[model samples]
Every structure is written in structure tokens, then in C-alpha cells.
Target: MTPPRRFRAGRFLDAAAVHAAADANPRLRRFMRTVAGHGDAGEVRARRLLEHIIRHVIDDVGDLHLGNAVARLERIAVLRERIAGILDHVLEGGTLPEGVRVEALGESFDQLRTEMRELSRPRDGIVGDAPLRLAEDAAAYADSMLREFEAGGGAAGLHSEPAAAVNDAFRAMPADRQAAVRRAAALEPQALWRAVASETEGGKRAAVADLETRLGGRLTPDELSRLRTAVDDLGVARNRGLQVSQARLAEALARIVDPELRAVVAGGDVWLTQQLALHNPEALATLWRRFRDRGGRADDGPGFRAYLRHDMVTYGRGVLGEYTAAFSLSSIELFLKGPDANVKVAGTDLVGIGHDGWVWLVDDKSHRATSVGGVSALTDNLVANLRRDAADFRDAITRLQRDDPGFTPDPRILDAISRMEDAAAEIERINRRGSAATRPARISRALEERRLRLRVTSAAGEVREITQALRDLGLAVEPTGAPVPLPPTGGR
Candidate 1:
């Protein structure tokens, strides 16, 4: 545990805390569960795994301030208790996932851990990380898109820029309507009417009809028709102008060079599937197979990282959520980043080392919770993309089957596909009923978090009862219990 350089109290303590936190890393615990053995072999194997998990976490985080061998060995001793529970479960015939070659598992874990390593190596800054300006513009665009999505537009509308949509629609409006709106606006300005315009194409039309009603007595039927058309055209143009400002925000995200920021900025499932399919193809397939065998399927699909990002975005609206969190903590004397590798490692988002050297580690929820893409776009993206990617996985599997006819999907994966299809359909149903006014259910979270729990209980007498039942049914049932019946000894 290398302490923060300022508090050179001991790096060993920092190492201990890092080890403790790494011990909680899901990959390690999942591995421990996989290699559960009760006796000597189990403990030996468990210690080896503990060693790998701790070393790998520190390595990936690039923090070398770990405590000495004695501290690590002691940490191993503590981890053995977890192994003991795993062994007990295994010894009781707890079904485990099919074992992978340790090398494959290790390689996969290493790659995945790289994805989790905080990308603090700033590409944009002069000294270190250039402080990123809050993406308020992207947030505005997303808000307009969300309003559109709420007003009976499909989830696909999330990508349609309000400015772009209205611009195109206005160009298509009738010429008479075009001229009428120009004259009406020149005389009495529909600034307030335009204010309500960009919600969607449907919303703009509705606003036009309202304006026509307010001026009911003034025009001939043809004149009214032209007036209505002209007013909506101007309204849409106004909305487009506003969204043009908002649309500029999309660039802040697009211009981003960092992969992690881009991924979360890009939305959760989209990033997850792209990374899995592209960067971690080998790791993805391996983890997918491993997770399937262990009973993980569908949205619970192979990506643990995706699940974390979704929760982050769901809670934080994404723009400067951490800055808002940190603003409360900072003073002229406070450190900007976590300077301690052991207690407060590099990835620590907000580190408040008080003037007295009291290191306050604040886990900034906003890191994952908020997004520059706006809340509605981010939320629906997870819902939409999870369904899309699962279908993609199935299509790939089907294509593989075509190449090698004997290839059959793990039953769990098939089940996952079915559930994903059903959930996607359900979300569409919710969208159709116009219940999308409030947040439509997050399909990714539901899909990813849904678990099929199977419980097995061991009884003291079930084995004996089975043996007796077999005997009664006229079958030779051997009773091999303690005081084992000696085989056919002649009178001896």
C-alpha cells in the first residue's frame, strides 16, 4: 500500500486497500466460484487464483505501490475463507460452469480489465488531463429528442435531430402556406408559437392547428388552409434554429478521442456490443461460453461492463454530474485528483484530500450516471440496442450453424434470445400505447439483470429413500452405506 506521495506514511497500507478492493472485483469472485474445491487441491488452486486476480488488478490499474509479499500472502489467507465457501458449495454438488483453460480465462480477464482501467492518460491536455467542458449542447439536443420520443414518435426518432427534421419538413410545406405564415409573422410575430414547435413533426402540426383556431373568424377556407401551413412552416424553422444550437452538442461527443468516454457518450449497449464484437471477439466468445454454462444468458449476456454503465447513465444525466458532485467538496486547499495509489487509486473520480490530509474518497456516481447524449436518448438507446445486438448474436450463431451444421446454441442462449425478443416486443408495446411520457422501462437493465434462479436443497434421507424405492419396484438396488455389506464372503 504505497500511500499518497504527500502522506508517505507507508505504501503498504495503500496496497492492502487496493488488494481489498480488487478482491471485490467481480472477475475474481466469479473465478473463485468456478474453481471451488473443499480440500487441499481446492485451497492450493484458490490461492493461485487469488494471486492472479490481485496482481492483474494492480497491473491493469498501473499502480505498483502494492504491499510486500507478506501482506499479499496474508491477503491470500483471508481470501481462502471465500474459497472454502465455494468448495462447500461445490462439494454439495453445486453445478458450476464448464471449466475453461485457465490460460484462456486469465487472458480474457486481463483484456476485460483493460477496458475498466480509467483512461486518465489524457490525449487533449497540456500538463495532464485537459479539463473537459460540460457538454451542455449535446444535453439540449437529447432533451429535444426525448420530447419527440414522448409525443408518440417511435424510439427511432431519438436520432432525428429536431432542427434537421423540421428543416426538411418545412421545405416540403405548400407555397401558399409558406407565404401566409411569412405575412402573419411579419404583422404579429408568432415567437411564442414557434417556442412550442420542435417537440416533433406531429407537435409542430398541432401548434399550427391551435394558431388557426385562435384566428378562426378572419380567413376564407383556402386562406385559412394557407395560413395554417405558413404558420407551421415558420414554427418548424424556429425550432430548427434552436435545435441547430443543440445539435452542435453532438460534436462535443463526436470529437472525443477517448474510447471509454466515447463508449458511455455513445450509449451503453451500443458501446458494449461494439467492444465485444470488435475489440474482444476472442474474449467475448470465451466469456459468453463461460457465462452461458454458468447460467448467465440474454441481457445478462456476457458483458458485466455494460451493466455498470447503464446504471451510471440512469442515475446521472451525464453532463458534469461529477463536477456538480465535486463542486461541493473543493476548496483552494483540496487536491483535484486522488494522489494515493493504495487508498485512492488513479481511477478514483473525485478525491478530496482535506487540508489536514484526511483523504476522503468520493465514488462519483455521475461518471456513469449522466451522459452528454441527454437522458431520453441514452435510456432508449440501451433499450433499443440490447434487442438489436442480441438478434445480431443470434444471426451470427445461425450463420455459424450454416457453416458447420452440427453447431447448436447452448440452450441458455436460445432461452436468452427468446426473452430478449419478448422484452423488445414489450417495450414496443409500451411505446405504442404512448406510455413513453414517463421513462419507458429500461430494457437493458431488465434484460441484463434478469436471472433465472435454480435452487437445490440436500436432504439427509433422499438417497436411502431412492434405494428403498428401487428395491420395492423389483429392481436390484445396492445399499452401500457405512458398515458396507461385504461382498459374498463364504461363511467367514
Candidate 2:
């Protein structure tokens, strides 16, 4: 038989959490104070139980099935109240009829796990989720209970508002369904409060100082000031959109020079959508699930949004070998074939056909910001290579002119080479100036042209290593002094 047709969660407004909230009022607060500092073995157990309940049970694990979720929360409440009762008796300095019955208490959890296993099992044609609003409803209801409980001086309101929640849950349903639900609820007296579970913290934080650590890899050495100024919430700010400014994104993009790789980072118009689909699909799972289930993006916390940006920036790190082929302006046959035709292995970025049956190969000297210092080592080698290539081309033209009296070099090509030589000289001067620099507040203000200079280096060393492998394979490879243009930038 076909499973129930998937319905939008809005069809059923957020219902009461089938489970009630745990009360941590003044009684529990006093209990915590006594135990948290130093108390007997029983106080220690109570404190441990409260911590476990707070960390695990109330955590909102975000289950897809309502029954499994309800069971988990329902049993957690049972456990909390049981501890509350024990604490109450201990505070009164009286021996209770029943203390913490380890076996009996553990049974509630065991039952929850069993029901979760049973409910979580795959059913025929049942690729459906419970109403997403249910989790919202649970959390809201619990918060309301907490507010009311604290307002009542904590000691009171333990049993307050019990009937209202179950009643409200069924209120959205038809009269007949409401009657049936209330009849089935069979609620107990003095057992009030419940809420739904959610996923773990998704890189959200209370302070800007926290972001520096989590996002340390993505940021430049002196990027905290820009990031602090970027958003007051430290990138957790959410209203109707998960918007990361294009400027901030470009700043986070580091010193990437490749256009395709830059596109992967900046993500152009769609921003994070394309980048997530390309590299980290799982990062967008919850958001997509919400879209599928509710046809809307929930006000999911900043943690959720922050995690998304983190994922995009994390994988957006440029690949040395793959992007080397991506920037080819020639008919390069990539060794590592991918959906994108331009992707190629590292050493052979641009391997295309040359005239007279000669094979043309362009090896990328990809460097990462992590590996290279960006200014000194990069420009030193780059300046040397370009000058040598220009001189060799000039000498070759001179020799050709000697043979053919009317031999004239293409002024456009000669100008291109000369213009590049001049550019290289300017690059050298800038590199020297950058060698001894002071730390600036912002990247834009710091070394205005640092990214441009850093873009000069590409992945090297790999090609030289491949030289021995080729010689071993009897290829007798010889180095060429051909006029190659400036190489691409470093990989991740």
C-alpha cells in the first residue's frame, strides 16, 4: 500500500509537544547550587542527572518522525520529574518512599530507545517527515512554561498549564479529531511542560572573539577587525535572508586568482546556493528539508546559517591541479576527466596540440596561502623566469633576422613581451616594499596590491618530481625554453 501523501507542515499548525517540558524552577535551581559546588553522593547524582538531561534530552536532536521524538521527550520529562521529587524529599530532610530507582528510571529511557528504533525503521513508500512546526511548537510551549514557572517564584506552577497544551494541540484539528485526541491524551495531574529537540550548535557564538577561532582557516592573519565590522552578530545575523555581503565574501576568498575558482568562492548572484551544490551538498540538507517539507525557510538559528557559510568557504579552497587546467585558453586534454571539461591533473594544466606535431605542455606552479609567504619567494622566481624567457625570445628573433635580411618580429607579440617585462619589474619593486610591512586593520587597507602579487605563484615542485617518473618510463623528457605567459595562482 502507498504511504500517506506528504503534507505541508502548515496543514497542521504546530501542535503541543506530545511530551511535556522539564521543570527547572527555584527548587531545581536550589538543588543545583547545593550539588554543583559540593554535596554528598546523592547530590552529585542529581547534579549529573540535571546536566545529562540539559545536554542530551533537552538538546532537540531533530528527528524526522513525530512518535519517536515524542517518546524521547516524554520519557525525559518523566526522568526529570522523578529526580525533582527525590530532590524535594532530600531538601525536606525526610526519607522518601522511593529514592532513585536505577532500574525503574532506566526503563523509561530503554522504552524510548525501543520505540525510536521501531518508529525510525524504514517503511514501504514512507519517505516522509513529521510536521516541522511541531518542533517549533514544542520549543515555544516549553519556553512559555519556563517563563510562567519562574514568574510563580519557581516553587509553584509545576502542574500549571497542563490541560491547556494538550487542548491547544487538538484545537487546530476538527471537532471530531480534537475530541479523539483529548480522549487519547489521558494527561496526568502536576506533570506540566515539554518541547521539541533541535540539531547541535551550527557555529553560532555569543562573541566576535569566538569567530576568529572557528573561521581562523578562512580568514587572513589580520582579518578580525574587518570581520568584527562586517556584522554585529558576527555573521549570525538573520532576518528574512541568509545574506553574506559580496564584499565580505570576496575578502574571505583569500588570494585566489583563477576566475572559475573565484566563481566557486564568490558564487556570483546565487551566492551560497551554487557553491553548496558543487562541493558540500550535505551542508544544505536541513534548509532543503525545510523547503521540501514546508515550502519555506524557517527562522532557523544563526548557527544554521553560520554553518552554511563555513561549509562554502571551507570547500571553496582552490585545487592546484584541477583549476590549473580550468584556466586554459587552449585545447588542453585533461588527464583527470570531470563533468567540467577543463579540469585536468596538476602537472599538466595546459596540454594541447602545437604546430608540426609538437606537444605543448603548460605546468602550473600552484602555491597555497598556507604554504607560501606570498611576496618574497613567489616574485623572486617569477621575475627570474619572465626575464629569461623574454631574453631567449629576443635572441631567437635576432638570429632569425641574421638569416633572413627582411625578418621582422611581430611588434604586437614583441610589445606584449616587453609590456610584461616592464610589469614584472614593477612587481619586483612592490615585492621589495612588501617584504618589511606593518600589520594593518583591514585587508583592503593593508597591502592594497598584496592579492595581485600573491596571485603570481602557482603549484611548482610537483612537475619536477614527475620528471623522474617520466625518465624511468623511457620518455627521455627534455626541458623547453618556449615563450610561456604568466602562470596561474596557488591552490588551496
Candidate 3:
């Protein structure tokens, strides 16, 4: 009886050759050194080094006779497989296999090195063209092998049961179906993951089933099971990441003192929660310092607004709802005459009357300050809103004075309107000439200044401005002071 074919460890030979080349070849040595020194969170450095070596070898092989090229391609395929095995061993903390000698494998690369050097030297034009064609064919073969290796997840993926299963399913698909799946994956990765993580088992099965159907029933029962297992693994990994992020965010919020602010943070919108959870705590702390440096005070409106602006600008709209909730204010409605009938318009993000009947209008602007275009749009919107509010306030005050005769309009309200008008004018000027020379720098500086002014004059500024206005009106007014018995938990 014929003996069963024994598995030969080609990786030992591949690893020896790579190490030997690093010592002999200046280019390869520099690459290996750079890769060794580079910092990577996991086995990424190993994977990149492996890919670079494979490409380098393919490039060096250059052109050969058809028969020689075919032989060279086969050798490269065997070498890649062995390299992957070596990577797995290294990543798993195993030393290189004993008795592997560089001299044994160095012969394999010697001919390719000679060919590469010869290609660089000027030769007969007709002869050079023939080598060039052969070189292209060899490169194509190398690329095909590389794609297959990557698709199988290199050496590390071979050990992962889920990844192995996924590869099995991927390989089972026809070439066209595989291409289609790749396209779909590229277009909507999040959607694909969501489908895999469907709440119901039936939904999950159906999604996979649909995928199989799209692939023209290419997936077998065993392959389908493997795909399901792989999907579950991916879902579990994603969920774990989200949980860790949420815990970090919760820990950060625990440091906050005010119950209202805590509530705001706790009651964050989905976008805000995701942002805060993933956001670096150290970065957040740095921003907090900047806020304090900019005259921000905790438990105050300006402080809260500054925090919101900084967080929003850095991390996007994830912190908007929670920070906006820091202010306890009433929403108001105003009536306006429309072309067809009377139209009721909602006031700004927050509106309220102080003890002395001084009205305050605040538009959070969380939406409009997230992007460059949003900044420009914000200026326009703020100007329009301020004008409308000022007109409405004037009309209402005039009506009150006519009706009571004893009613005295607060001069502070007029002053606030005037300040808003001036701010609006400045914003408009900036918007119009914002495209002049040094446009980006000018716009960026203007935006920063405006953001600072908004933080100072809006929430925090509103608190101080209203307080002073009440005192001027001969009404006893004091700050709300911090809320008592702060919640033990961050939020409800």
C-alpha cells in the first residue's frame, strides 16, 4: 500500500529565507527594521510585513521564460503558505522551528535576484520587451495568490474557527457571486452587520437565506451553518465593544457634580451616547480645561453651553440633547400672520421669563455648528431668528403698554435685542466676505470667535444678563444655586 503523503512544513524554509534576506539585502533589511520598530496594537505589524515581503519577492522575480515563470509562480505560492504558517507560530509566542537553515532556502531567491539585477541593465530592445511581458504575467500570478491569502485572513485567521468558517462559505460561492458579495459589502457594511445581528433568529436566518439566494443557491447546508456561526461571532464582538464604550462614558459622567447636568448627560441621545462612550477621556479632560480657561464655570449656563459646544465641535451632535437639557426653561409659542391664516411659531430652543418679567430667547444651535457649511447656515438662521424674535417681542410689549398704560417695557430686553442685532450684522459680514483671500483661515478664526461669543452671551451670558436686568428693575433676584441631594446615579 502507498504511504499517506506526509505534511511538509515549508514555513520553516520560508521563515529562514526571509531572515537571511534581511541580513543580505539592504532594501529588505531596511523594510524589516522599519516593520520591527513600528508600533501596532496587535498582529497588524506581522501581517503588513508578510504582505510587503511577498510583494517585494514578486517584484524582484521580474521576467523569465514561460516555463521558468510558471515554476517561479509555483514556488511563490508555496513560499506564501509557509510564511503564513511562520506568522501564526510567531503570533502565538512559539519560537521558530529548529533545524531550519537559511542556506537551504537562500538558493530559491538567488536566481530571482540575478534576474532583477539583469532587468535593470540596458539590453537589446526586442529582448527587453519579451522579458517585460513575462514579468507582467508573473506579477499577475503573484497578485492572484496574494488575494487568495488575504481572503483566507493570512495565518492568524486560520486559527479562528469563525473566520475559517466564513472563508469556507466565501470560497463556496461562484466567482461572480463572490464579486457581487464584495460589492455589496463595500457599499453597506453596517447594514450587512445589522442583518447578521437581527433581533430574531428567524430574521437572522432569513438574512443569510436571502444572501444564499442572491448567490444562486451556492451555499450548502454545512456552509450556511458556518456562515451563521461567523455572523454570530462578529455580532458578539461588536456588542462587546459597544458595552465597553458605554461603561467608559458612564464612568466619565459619574465625576460630574450637578444632578441636572448628570441627568442631561445620562439622557443623551443615541448619537451623543455613542460619541461619549467612544470619546477618549483624556481628550475630554483637555477640552474641559480649555472651557475653564475660557471663563467657564460649572453649574452655570455659560459653562454648560461651552461644554456642549466643545464636545459637539469635537465629537459631533452626540452631546447636544444632554447639554441642551442643562437649562431648565419653558418652551413658548408665538402667533404670526401667514398668507392664508395665522401661523403659530415655536420660540427658540429655550425661552423663559425671569422674576422681573424679562424674556430670554435661546436657540441651541446644536444642529448648525457641526460643519463648515453648517456654520455659515447658522449665521443666517441666527440672524433671521433674532430679527423675528425682536419684532415679536416689540409687538407684544407695545400691545401691553397700550392696554395697561402703567406697563413699562424693560430696557434690558431692548438692549439684548440690540446686541443680537449687532452680532447678526457681524455674522452676515463674515459670511459675505468669508471667501476672500486666506478664506479658510479667515473663516476658521471668525467661526471660533463667534462660537466663543455664543457661549459667553447665550446660556452663561443669559444667566448673568437676566440676573443683572432683574436687579436693575428693582426686583430681588438671586441665582438658582445648585440643586440639592444630587442623584446617586448619573441619570434616570
Choose the strongest candidate by TM-score. 3
Ranked by TM-score from best down, the candidates are 3, 1, 2
* lDDT for position 328 in model 3: 34
Give the clash count for model 2.
13
Judge candidate 1 against the unseen true structure and give its global Cα lDDT, from 0 to 1: 0.40
Winner by lDDT: 3
| Candidate 1, run of 10 with poorest lDDT | 452-461
lDDT of 2 by residue, 1-492 (tens): 111223223223111121112222666645555654473533223433343333222223222344345555676577667656665876797664364565654665676555455555633112446423323466765565455434644322111122233334334444544332232222311111111110012212232344344454554543434334333221222210123433545554544443433443343323344344434545445444544365333443333344455433332322433354334323323222121223222222332222322222333343233232222222335456445555755787889999998988766446535643664576456555653332111222222222111122232222222333222212221222221333333111
Give model 1's clash tally: 22
Q: What TM-score does structure 3 among the candidates reach?
A: 0.22
User: Each model's C-alpha lDDT?
Assistant: 0.40, 0.37, 0.43
Tell me how many clashing residue pairs each candidate has: 22, 13, 4
Give the lDDT of residue 408 in candidate 1. 83
Measured with C-alpha atoms, the lDDT of residue 130 in candidate 1 is 44
Q: How large is the C-alpha RMSD of every model relative to the true structure?
A: 31.5, 29.1, 27.2
How close to the true structure is residue 38 of candidate 1, measured as C-alpha lDDT?
49
Q: Give the poorly placed runs of model 1, Cα more than 4 Å off.
A: 1-172, 175-210, 217-230, 238-319, 330-347, 355-357, 366-492
Q: Estimate each model's TM-score.
A: 0.21, 0.19, 0.22
